[model samples]
Target: MTRHARSERLLLCDELDRLGPDRPTLCEGWQTRDLAAHLLVRENRPDLSVGRFVPFLGGHLDREQRRIANGDYAAVVDRVRRGAPAWNPMSNAKVDEITNLIEFFVHHEDVRRAQAGWAPRELAPQLEGKLWSALRRSARLMFRKAPTGIVLIADGRGRYAAKLPDAHGTVVLRAPVGELVLYAYGRKGVARVGFEGDADDIAALQGAELGIS
Candidate 1:
């Protein structure tokens, strides 16, 4: 579970190369190649903060959408690889590297899920826990002043959601952890996930909290 900075980069490149242009990704309007390009850009640019990253991300997203439209992911890959730079967003190489890991991990699975492919066998368990907390803790200000009884669960990582508000029994969801990460980002909903109970409600709750809906 001890994730290092360099390993995350290797994972990104490996996954992207492995995915290639023949696959589809979970990021809605993106093909495997397009998604790879988008991620390449993000990983390289970790110098920007969340706010700055948004604008930069928007441009890549626009390009990505076009790549998918043309169904020519190969071109997109070429464009990015030609003269692209790595602009770490977090301002902390070590910190941003972990963040980068989260990004690559989630997006990689996003693409795989869209194509019904399998997850990478080498995914790090250490990251699995942090990602869940990052998502739940992210909603701290947006949700209640403090966490109620909500027991936000993502397996080994007992992340935020300390405020359950009287909900009994953990709202268990048996989904690919990667999909769960995207869900946290408001990139998808329950329909796109494997679930147990009240899928609609979970989606609604997640959407409302994350502002996806």
Candidate 2:
């Protein structure tokens, strides 16, 4: 898991370098520089990472992010490439494996799938299995605000339920686990996932707010 996470991080950094700082990414209103800074802050700045969940500190967090992002673009990417600093929890191998595997993979896809002419890369079967495991555990939280219950059907791998509270109905989304991860992360338009169920339920799930930042 650590190996996968580290590889994804390095690849993301390479993409940022290739695309340059001003290039647009899938993250709303954020350019490559902003995304790079976000990755850095996520791993290194515990103080601001808390603001991701606590609304009151968001302003301060945004301010600090902008300040960090103002550094040389290459330098910022280099920092991300170098991995989390020694004092950071993510610097611990086990913690990084548990936490950042999905984080980096999703963010990596955010940059890749956002660009024109982009295509999904083939992933190793083991990596896909790992992603599926993570999705099963996180599906509920990621889709907590979903308007309908979601049953994620990974082609040839079986199914897992996303138990959203107050769900009006259920929708089944079928795709490879890799694609399902993208859809679960709210990338419905680009994830290549297919839907089945009552039209209303499908529509509700498709349009609902899904995934965490």
Candidate 3:
């Protein structure tokens, strides 16, 4: 049902290889090499993965990630292409599909959209549906601090209330499902979604910090 996860992972690895280690990505300060190393740590070092969500261990994670990124860039990409190692729970096909589908797709776009002249890819209907479902599951957390009410609207894909209305009211973000996913992931600088609502509320939403770390 979620085979797109594997395809997206492979595609991201290909782009990492093609673009080389120094290319920029939409991930704040992370270059391609840094992103690849983060992926490796995410899948292979469960101990370090906690650092991503735990403020105290952030330094340790950063140090370890830098250690990995400083190595042979080609070797890093090759390891990512091989997928999670057998010892990692992510190596289980079902677990990988459930967890990595959104992770890989968003990171793929992180690399793609950072490049000049890049445009959104037309995702298959099945992939779109899966992304929409994933968004539904995580929308509230992603939009938790949004200044206004939040609704995501994708034509022919239905709408979801990511956050209920605040005093300023709701803002509707209209775009393809994939774009919505990107926006929810803090790729606001590159996501092509449009907004509908009170001008002030929309503006407030635009300025608000959105997405998970």
* Candidate that would win on TM-score: 3
Clashing pairs in model 2?
A: none
Question: Candidate 1 vs candidate 2: which has greater lDDT?
Answer: 2
Off by over 4 Å in 3: none
Q: Which digits, one per residue and each the tens of the lDDT, describe model 2 over residues 108-199?
A: 98899888999888888878887898899899888888888778899778999887435667788899898998888887778998888888
> What residue runs in model 2 are displaced by over 4 Å at the alpha carbon?
164-167
Residue 29 in candidate 3, Cα distance off native in Å: 1.1
RMSD of each: 6.2, 1.7, 1.2
- Clash-forming residue pairs, model 3: none
Instruction: Count backbone overlaps in model 2.
Output: 0
Worst 10 residues of 1 by lDDT: 141-150
The alpha-carbon root-mean-square deviation between model 3 and the true structure, to one decimal in Å, is 1.2
TM-score of 1: 0.57
**Model 2, TM vs. native:** 0.94
Scored against the true structure, residue 46 in model 1 reaches a CA lDDT of 42
**Please, what's the RMSD in Å of model 2?**
1.7
How well is each residue in 1-213 modelled by candidate 1, as lDDT tens digits? 354344544554555567777576666666666665555445343442232347756665565455443565555554433323444344455566545555555554565556553534434666665555555655443344221233344555553443444342234444344445565555554224444445554544553444232
Say which candidate scores most in lDDT: 3
